[model samples]
Target: MRRLHTLSAVSMALSGAISGLLLPVAAFAILGESVEGIDSSWVFVVAPLGLAIGVGYGIARYYRFSYELTAETFDVTSGVLSVQSREIPYGRVQNVDVRQKLVHRLFGVAVVSIETAGGGDTEATLNFVAEDEANRVQAEIRRLTAAIEADDGDDTRPAPSTEADTSAGDRTDSAEPRAARELLFELEFRELLLYAGTAIRPGAAIFPLFLLLVLTGDPTSLVPESITELSLVALSAIGIVAWALATSAISAAYTVAGYYDFRLERDGNDFVYERGLIERYSGSIPVEKVQSVTISDTLLQRLFGYASLSVETAGYGPGDSSGSQSTVPFAAESRVYRFAEGIAGVERPQFTSHPAMARRRYLARYAILATLVVAAAFLTAQVIGLERWYFAAVAFAAVPPAAHLKWTHMGYYVGDDHLVIRRGFWRRETTVIPYFRIQTVTTRRSLFQRRLGLASLVVDTASSRTFTGSVPTIENMGLEDARTAHENSRKQLQRTLRDRARDENVGLSPEMA
Candidate 1:
């Protein structure tokens, strides 16, 4: 279609200037004494050079990048030095997202990201187009795909349809209403505040303390010998408070930046999310493309009756931003469950806990780990001539209780159409994956598990919120129970495939069936 916004050049120039600023610091850090008397003014030269390069590059990129939409395929051609082109068929398009940074918003432009079913990362990104044009493009793609799916009666094929051949000029009228209608959920200001505040990571609280320990090599080293003991205590207290405030402020900004004005809505057959303040983003997944829905809550969230929800789609990867696939970043626990059930197309799954011996196993494992930690702490304290050796015993106090909670929380449910895995100690997560989405299944056992006649059922799907390339698991099931669950999942998968093939008039090979 059209080229990116003209301001793309300025954005590139700013990016280049930032990179240029970092060059001097990096060079100085690396060179140290080697260039002791070098003219630091030369660093100033780098920024202008970078800006020139960026401007030239941006101009070339704008001219070389172009896209064209055909009835069945969307073609994009990009590159300056080495030209690259791709034609993604409507059937192959997995997900489409629109994003806008502060500058782009000010200029009324947005970036559109497209992903495919075959890849974990974005296939193409259309740089800054008019915000309305971006929305029209996203909606048009969904409309064409949906029309193709309906006519073909198949999920994986593009069918010819007169309705899908509309020109870009007609797309605004044809697609905008479908995309903008049907509100499902939107975050209110109060809920947004709770979400931001409670979402402050535990790491943030510990980070300042960790930095102090690393920098000084000992907590007491923070107090200089020349300082009075009372002054030292006061200074330490103030530092802790300051770090706490800094951490809270950082967490709040991060949450607000990523999730401002968050809204989730149903656009035709797709579930769409639009959010962000400075960098607005709109992401969507077809209802059928969703593989699983997960609801999770931290210890604090539980107290506040809040939880977060995320959906797993075939093209999403762990490296993607956490908020990208989030359905509800933070909301009441009850509402989270309601949304999960609707999107996942299943009732809240009933779960069965692992056998009683699993508790003993967890207790044994935690006891040994805690014992080792306490021993290490005691030895360190002794070597440092520290008087807080007894603090190490605190480790022993929490171990058994945490182990008990972990064991109690470990459970799974093989339902009519979905399998649910529930686990985690403090931040509990419950994931519901449909059987049709499962790609593989296996069972594994550690030496200890084997001795205890227990096995872990590992189910895998193309979709994963965890980057480890694995899906939800049923761990520590008795051997017989594991086998039964494995067998049930396989049967359900076959049934789903067969039914799909029958409805689509597609023949599945015996292996697929």
Candidate 2:
């Protein structure tokens, strides 16, 4: 068994001390001492006690935590009170991630996260291990996983010695040779700048507007009694433009910081990626575990002919907060597709657009939304006696173009081995899901869609839910077409499974077969 780096005690002690200090602070606030002017010198007395207790707890925790990398399992034993132990099998490990914050780097330590299939979060975390030791642990897990796959069905094979050296310092002496690595993609500085410039962060943009409103105070107070109306309008316009520029610069800087010096490489069956500037992350996505591949671009990026490619594996989804799944954060659309093809064996697909009625459906939907907006504006005008409320009618002008873009972008294609679905207008996405990876397929029709003789075909996979909280669906297809696609997907899934089973059987020995 191996212990965490000694430095972890320092970090743990700091955390515990902070937590302990919060207790007295909370008590002081709850007691209303500030209003009553109660004596507070007792806090000084409690502070040292908190620090000592915190240090003691930290040291105990450091000594208590230990882990072992066995032949077929990665075992961890931890917890100060009521110790808990877990053994994670090698074959089930989906991703081994190494993360180093600025502090961790200063301490020459890193956190290693082991993620297993069906585990919503990391299965185990080896916090504050030596950087080199972390890498060794990740590599050993991969080597063991590969070995287990190779030895499947061979129950007679002897397990490696349980007494094997598991110490962090000595394990490397008997470690397997590193796999040959091929440079796959690296983000260029110029492309990184372009990506940052084109990236749209609505949340960040809205924040500045809110801040401006809050800082400016009451809206009516912004107009001074001596100021002319025209000058006030001019000042507002200038402020809005300045706010826009400020928000854009802030968003760009954020993107640059996150994706600085991104690099990706293929090592045997896994693709490894490292990115970030202040807080670095290195993660692996096993090729065989990939559930789907997505090529997406925002409206601005699309106009610039750039897109991003990301893969969804059993361990990481696009929605994962870690954000390590993106293989190529920014590249030319053609180049992105080429890289995606290499990863998932999917070519640039020729999509079939939804039926003409789908276009009518979109037009009707947007028109209804515009009409509702106009009606609400008119009602507000009557209630508040405000002029120029008719300005809301301008939304009608956007309905046609918005509807057209929606129809133009929505399409689907059923390839020989993959099902492709494309949707969205502001941020277009094209997802390719392999038949074998698909978990479910279903068809649905809303009341309006039924009237239009249209239905949606939803495709689900083992990949976790996306950030948008939506499943992969090909919408506004002819009812019959949707049903046909649903049935075909089911049949293809079965065929792919059978082919895989046959290949596995062929590799097995006669006795095991």
Candidate 3:
């Protein structure tokens, strides 16, 4: 099986490299270089270089083994010069991730990633496996855990919408294929637009704009005239606007490319998320390893009804991002809330009383804004003179950015099952993470907020993609409210787990109970 994987990858690599290497021949022909006069050393270098390219491809393909199993172990091994193998114990297994690039999908293949909890720096990745085998591998992993639960007399349930799978992997030269459940979910075009919006963030255009500015600058001087023209103020407005538009377009293009026609399918315990444009990619996450599932939306998405999804799971060994995250990319704003719940499959109680600050809530930001406004005014007052009418006019004009910040910053709320946070403009995001998935929750007090008897909360979790990865929120809220939110969420998790246990105990009556 490993050899088969190796051969397939090598073939693909060689096909591309061979085509590229032919460019030299084209160049030589154009220059009228005689083929007969070509040195033997050139062939020696080129032949081995071409062959090494194939080997490189094979090395990357490197799957030790791929198969399905019962409540025991699944083994995969393959490496040529230095053989490496792993026997992943069923109990230690954390998650199963399945992904595919455009190439793999074209070949009806999926990359299977097996993740376990025990190994500190352990990883297992099978580059190209038949989708059937990928499902088989996932099913076997879940089956083993179920078998253990049954033996321990613990009530175990299969995944929602999935039936108990009875098929076993065939152990033969011509093994009978096991059919695993193909769970299908797709993203809406509107959601894709939202995805395009976020995926192409500010940084998207920073590099391109920087490059363009550099191009328009004295390259030999190492600094652009745009930086220098800032003193001239009005002079660079055209250049700055051009830069902003260019960046927006670049970001928009990036958003489109990153998430095109995203799909996620569950094959047993493994979840496969498919996405991308030209350099297509597929990412997988395992259920057991799932730390959290987050449905997030920017303000624009909220208006348009779209959101992006992120899943945090145990990573496959080391250097394996399979269990990391996958997003719908683009989704309509209205559908975001429903889609998020659909993925979570649970109703969390949300407090109807949305937390809000009185109009005075924007006072917290007043000090900072005053600094900027006063400075701008002071500079003008100093340079142009602090004339009575001009000073009054500047003071009034400065009120808007501060007022906008205050209004935008004016929201906070608690949900029965999750916490909701919103911040930013144009890229405003509302993120929802279930209490069950909360790993670390803490609050910080800036010196000023501390003096004001207010603080901020920071929420951190494993799945680094779907969620902001790290949410450091500074909202104008009471200290007690922050603590209560954390405590309530924690208590809810305990109750849910206990309820699950109690509900699973059907024959627990009196003595037997």
Q: Count the backbone clashes (under 3 Å) in each candidate.
A: 1, 0, 24
Per-candidate Cα lDDT values, in order, are 0.75, 0.80, 0.53
Model 3 weakest lDDT span, ten residues long: 504-513
Q: How far is each candidate from the true structure, as Cα RMSD in Å?
A: 6.5, 5.3, 9.9
Each prediction's TM-score versus the true structure: 0.81, 0.86, 0.62
Worst 10 residues of 2 by lDDT: 504-513
Q: Give the per-residue lDDT digits (tens) of candidate 2, residues 1-513.
A: 788887777778778788777777677666655557755767777767877787788778888889987877999998898799999988788888899988878877889988887646878998888887888788778777777877758864334434445444332444233346666778999999999998876667887777768987776576666766456557868888988898899889878888899988776677778888889898888777878888989999998899998878775676564667888899999888777777666788899989989999999999999999999989976964546678789999999999999999988998777899999999898988989999899898999999999999888888645535577888889999999899889998999888877663211111210
lDDT of 1 by residue, 1-513 (tens): 545555665665566556655766567556654767766566577646665666676667767887866778888999889999999987778788888878777777788888887767788887766676677778878877777777745555542223433322222233366435577778888888888887756556777677778888987666576766456557968987899887887787788888989887776677778899878888777776777778888778999889988877777764464448887888888878777766665666678989987887888888898888888978976765545556567777887788889988888998877888988867788888878889888998999999999999998887754422356788899999999999999999989777766653321111210
Identify the leading candidate in terms of lDDT. 2
Where model 1 places Cα greater than 4 Å from the true spot, the runs are 12-55, 153-175, 178-180, 200-221, 224-249, 467-470, 501-513
Q: Which pairs of residues clash in candidate 1, taking residues 3 or more apart in a chain or in different chains? A: 1-67
Question: Which one wins by TM-score: 1 or 2?
Answer: 2
For residues 1-513, write the lDDT of model 3, one tens digit per residue. 223344355555666466546654555555445556655446545655655665565545433333334235666665656666667776666666666666766676666666665443445766655666555555556666545544555464332213344322212122112244353557667656655655536566578657866776753353343443233344446667877777877877866665667676654445656666754555445554555554555566656555555555543222245223653445554344444555554343332222344224454455566667767766765753434323334554556566565455445456655666655554555555555556667777767566556666666545433334344353645677767766776787676566656543311111210
Ranking according to lDDT, highest score first: 2, 1, 3
**Model 1 RMSD in angstroms:** 6.5
